[model samples]
Target: MKKLMLALAVASLSSAAIAQETYTVTDVPVKEKSVETNSFWSNWFISAGVNYNAFYSSQEEGISKNPFNDRGKFGFNVAVGKWFTPGLGIRAKFDGVKGVQVNGGVWSPDNIDFDYWNLHSDVLFNLSNMIFGYNENRVWNFIPYLGAGVIRNCSQNNYMMGANVGILNTFRLNKRLSVNFELSALAAPKSFDGIGYKASGNKIWRGADKVFTASVGLTVNLGKTTGFRKAVDVDALMALNASQLDALNSALAAQQNENARLKEELAKKPKEVIKTDYRKEYVGAPRSIFFNIGSSQIASRKEIVNLQVLADAVKADSNIKLKVTGYADSATGSAAFNQKLSEKRANRVADELVKLGVSRDNLVVEGLGGVATLKPNSYNRRVIVDVVK
Candidate 1:
């Protein structure tokens, strides 16, 4: 019955570790670069491993006994674990020992036999960065964890509960798989059942048992998190935006002025009107289009295709510039939802334009939610393309 309960607990833990919630790709771009100093909450993982244990017994008189005549007795353990964050996690383990041998008798010397099983629950702390230099690139690949747990050991005639400490190392193969190795020390409570030996004229039994264990196995992650990349510091990114754009524009203007001056100097020296049939007449206008989607920015295929056509037209016209205005139909939903939906539509159009070879700097994008659009009109669902030359 105890063994059955232990097995159920381990199975439940394993299931929970494997079960994960998935996010949509449209919601978050998967290719976004991760920031170096992001919090650990974003990277969570789960694992399982096969383990081997060494059991050592002791007498009530404070005399410890080595179960092996000349070697330590061996056992087995299996565990399921999950990391709530990058460096912290919890694990549940099922452990058992068989063929345990102990010293017995002084008159007719022979070894006594004992066997037991244990169920444990523990919380793990990561220490890979402390021991080894683990920065962003390497941190995801190699990690070391230390943990402490309560152990419940059950035998044929005895049941003991105690505590244990352990250490483990994991090598991540990818986002969905990893290799794990673990080592632990289990301290079992005192037992008074006598072995087949007499000590100080009293029947001798093993006292507290200390067990050392090691394991290695592979872990499989079930549902994957969409954007596994590092987080971007929004504050830092926003702060850098204006300065970067200004520097870029300044450099571009300087180059354009230099080119114009050189062209004039060359024309003064000697010039010819090199007319070619390949030259195409430019007569395009710059346009800004606005669209109002409802509380959700999940555009249908038809809508996306319409936007694509609009983008292509702008791209074919070198003289035309585009400005996209995104709005929410009403203030019926939560303000936050409306704001996000508006932004989503704006970003979606901007992305499509970029794909159609429109320079992002030349395209202006803005979101005006709820406060502007009073009702849901099919015309309001429309994208207004204002062409400006």
Candidate 2:
């Protein structure tokens, strides 16, 4: 019994599982107009470039050489950048510039070779993608940036805080790599060049020092052909999950209901067991209909009337069933002939019950051969009909 119950439980669960379908979560591409819907770790880029820097500072007559005669210096910059949106990003950069001339006044007429290192944190904007939307195959993009950070003159052992602004032009080579051209200007305090000039017997300060820089570099994207990715909408995914759940529940309910009906049908079916004699108790009084010896037909109209009355009673209550037993006189013909006659009598009575509106299924017909007897042989050759409620 425990095993049966366990099997039933497992079957029920299996039905429920079959009713509820399973789904796998997949990456769905959704297009939106405004926001970047990409992976958080995507769109990172690093770049390395060589730069030419030109410096400008306050000069004095008769003491300052022409700085522009051999002005520009060689430098290199490296930057790591990330785009927060399709059009906006930030970069942290380092630059090392050498071979710059910091000229002195009358005290030191010669020029001193100077080198500087700069660190910058800059905000970047992609003008091309902003104006035309993003296109991977587009050959060129124009980006501009503004930054402020520290600059250290390694040769002079001095540090100064400054700001720079630049415009970058990029040409795409493939999805992951690009070539970049940049033009920028840097400005710092007057003492940034580490030179103080004396005029009229007093040391004087000048305007800010400025450097114009131009560079070319290779930019490499960190991951994927499409530099950026879009973010998935949480609400949309939640709604889909809820809808799928509702459908699963409805199917499960239907499966459960079907399983219950099958269980009921199975319970009602007859099982294989040992056959036993079941004594039937009758409802109301037992009635007898007499028949002539050797004749299976109903010869008397009185017998027919009695059969009709019994049929009506059984029909009135569907729960009532009738047992019809036919008997023959023991002193009559051979036992085999008497048994056949008895069966015919029983069947004739059952037919009458059916014609009188009683269901045939409600009448159980049987033949008892010439074995049992009553005092009157004529009465012995008769069919006995009794109601089993």
Candidate 3:
């Protein structure tokens, strides 16, 4: 009993360790747009991967002649999940796989090829804390799951209660489709029966069986709704009074007027004019650039300096409208915290640009706290200065 408890404890710890490591191991790609949680039901995922399993029983050991050993195997699963909330979801899956040989013993009159297959159900519990602990919001791209169900050993048609712990790394191939890579370990406390064939007569054996396997597949989601999509709309939400909205509108109008006046003034000033009619005919220089930093909002001094240079460049281009976009790295903090950091970063950069003579209207600032981005790159941390003519 103590050994069984110890094995269970170790398995739980292993599950937690792998769960913590999933986000750290994968590179989160950028999301070009906002994702709506209400639309989660629209997606279906199919995955194939290899897994390593360990069985818990003495009977399983005698039959296979190998216990607690790692076996190479392959498996595939299909799942449909729906997000009832941003961090909570429910998934139903059907998975099947065959075990690989782990022992090096020769197959003679005494030794026989050993393998097992299973079909089971899994309930997914995503570790929201792991997703919120990273510096990049792309942390959501990696989800760790724990599930319990009944396993049927196809070889002998025996049933056993089992549990699985795994990590899934998903790549959004598009809005409704994604590709998944999974690694898992399923544990069953049962032994392989019917090991000795007609030559030696049938006998029951008990032992531990370990299966290690891998697969790749795609998910397609349907029935999507955009209502649950949350974007940075604090200013809009904070406008409690009609007078405040009117004031904001007036301020926006005044800023636009000021921008127009500055453009006219610069056009008349020969010193500020660039003599490039051909350049004017082509696409205008980018007036704004956007960066998606994975879950962190802390701006380094270097980033500040880069913003300063950007502000200076915007000041030099009188016709430019600087749009500063602040992004959080994959979800590492509370939603509220990420949102605040994103807005603060954007506002900080905007305020600095304002000090450099860029009118507020020319700077459209916004924060996308949950926007995902490519991992392992600094390009996600950025400010776009579009020189809009």
Candidate 4:
């Protein structure tokens, strides 16, 4: 039935959180996080772009100041930077050529046209990587930066200290190249713009000379790109593997003994009535499909055995409707991330059932976000199927 599905995606081992790591259901262990650091210059990059600049000053308030009327407010920008880590980086950028500015203590219909350059070093923070975990292949990244620098006004032959802030949006075209869009604003001392308190009845304005720019550019990485790689704990994984094998062997033996005991008990009783083919032939099989932490794909071929038996039963009786539920552990990821992970697990199981000859219409697939229903959280990262009615 179609209905709202709540998924409890499960895993004691974390995919994104290292140390709060997660384990898998297969014999071979998988490492889902990275903690290694890269060498210097490994993540360096350079970019170049043209931008339309806008200037504003409190002194120009009385007049309608339009950047379009100021032909000097158009220029080019360039930068070179490096990512020290997935979430942090730094860059030195230059934007300039010519710009319009209001002169100190003077108000003019035609502002000063000044040839200059603004150079600043920014500390970059990749918001996406910081919040969602590092995913190198991620196409888009949102980076905000802050910095301080100096602006040289060539016409006035003077320099002023400046500060800047901005957001940089990057769309990765490949491992080595990215298309970038940037929005930034810079602030300088009012006197640097030839405008001072003396120009306006000696009034000290609250703001300074400001320039805003919007630009699009291309960035090419200077060297090899380094990404985080999973940390391997061989001894721990081997121990885990041994314990998991023991558990599986025990469960299988117990189930076999139960089946045999039931068969003997039935033989000792009176003749039973004939049941339908689906009910009479199929033996009880585990109805849960397990997966690795932070993964939806079935990891082992053995996981499909019981699922195959269930598929046959559905084929024998097409009327049977099975409920397929998926889950992820709450300990590994954020709620929103777990919700999506859970749905993927459920859908993967449903797809497998369909492959096994079960009609899609006869299946109700839902995700239950994150839960800790099982002893070991790794077992919870799975899809569970049962008869709907």
Off by over 4 Å in 1: 1-50, 60-74, 99-101, 105-110, 130-154, 192-207, 226-229, 248-389
What's the CA error at residue 121 for candidate 4, in Å?
0.6
Q: What global local distance difference test value does model 4 have?
A: 0.74
Off by over 4 Å in 2: 1-32, 60-68, 102-109, 196-206, 224-226, 230-389
* Every candidate's CA RMSD: 20.7, 34.2, 22.8, 14.4
TM-score of each: 0.48, 0.47, 0.41, 0.51
lDDT of 1 by residue, 1-389 (tens): 44344434444433332221111112221223332443344344445555555555453233344333322545566666655544456777777665343344321133344566667777777565434433433424344444444443333465556676766666667646767777777666544122422234333224455667777877655443411334555666665665556765775566556555545654564433323221121112222234534623434545554455446655676656767666565524557776676667777777876877777766777666545332223333333333454
Ranking the candidates on TM-score from highest down gives 4, 1, 2, 3
Q: Which residue pairs come into collision in candidate 2?
A: 37-229, 37-230, 37-231, 38-229, 38-230, 38-231
Number of clashes in every candidate structure?
Answer: 10, 6, 54, 31
**lDDT value, residue 72 of candidate 4:** 31
Against the true structure, candidate 3 reaches a TM-score of 0.41
lDDT winner between candidates 1 and 2: 2
- Candidates 2 and 3 compared by lDDT, better number: 2
Instruction: Report the lDDT tens digits of candidate 3 across residue range 1-389.
Output: 44344434444444433333332323333332334354434424434444444332322222443434433334556665665544445666666655433223323243333445555555554454235531213323666777776666666777776666777666765655667777676655535422321222243322333343345677665553411343434444454344455755775566556555545555566355333343332223332233444433334544455455556655667666766676555434456776776777677777766876777877877887644565443543444444454
lDDT of each: 0.51, 0.74, 0.50, 0.74
Residue 9 CA displacement from its true place in model 1, Å: 74
